[model samples]
Target: MAEAKAEFEVEFVGACPLWRGFEDQLAVALGAAAALEQKAGAVAVLLGDDERIAALNKSFRGKDGPTNVLSFPGPRVDPGFLGDIALAAETIAEEANSQGKSFEHHAAHLAVHGFLHLLGYDHDEPDKAEVMEARERAILASIGIADPYA
Candidate 1:
């Protein structure tokens, strides 16, 4: 039988012109990661600005600021509808510039990070963070992106 591949549906809203071809890049990055290869389903991605993300952060997470990415896991039923991920373009760009990493690489990392969350991965604790970060490093490396935590 053929392997199952996850599908990504991306929507752009509010100052996300800089991410014109990001959906393709994200698909490549996610494919390299192999996180969703065994599951046939869909993941929704939103590319928005700081203002939109900030509102979401505050409403959903009780935080009052914009973040790079946010993940919302789905019910995990048949056909595996994984979840949703949102990215803040401005914050990602700023973080990329500050970290000396290419914007594409950084954005890919964040996208992967959000995807992992939908797979029930979390980094709230040190041990969990270690595991999550390790997976992230390997995934990023598979796509020629350096260790994001390094």
Candidate 2:
């Protein structure tokens, strides 16, 4: 049998110059989770600096600090029209260092997390978290990354 097909377009906007080829990795990640399809719209993955992302975090999430990654599904929630995923480069790097994981690995995980959000996965509750994490683990494992929660 042939593998399922999925496509993604990723853009980095902040201080994250390390994720230039992340678009390709995202395709693999989504494909691994069986969460991809040849939809009619695009997925935007934006990466930027702490200040810019912090402002976004505060404005949208009601938090007053920079976060590692934030998903902006846009006003519309259709997966086909999936809008953007934002990552704070400074936050990601700092978190990765503190978490003892490579910048690339953590970055990859963030991308996966953002993609799941696009697919309507949220960790707002324990049961939801379990399902979401399982999906994340499968996706990451397919790409040769260890379980993010383990």
**lDDT by candidate, in order shown:** 0.81, 0.72
List runs of model 1 lying over 4 Å from the truth. Answer: 1-15, 35-37, 76-79
Specify the poorest-scoring 10-residue window by lDDT in model 1: 5-14
Candidate 2: residue 10 lDDT (0-100)? 49
Question: Per-residue lDDT for 33 in model 1?
Answer: 53
Question: In candidate 1, residue 147 scores what lDDT?
Answer: 92
Q: On a 0 to 100 scale, what is the lDDT of residue 1 in model 1? A: 100
Clashing pairs in 1: none
My TM-score estimates for the predictions, one after another, are 0.86, 0.80
Model 2 score (lDDT): 0.72
The candidate that wins on lDDT is 1
Q: How displaced is residue 45 in candidate 1, in Å?
A: 0.4
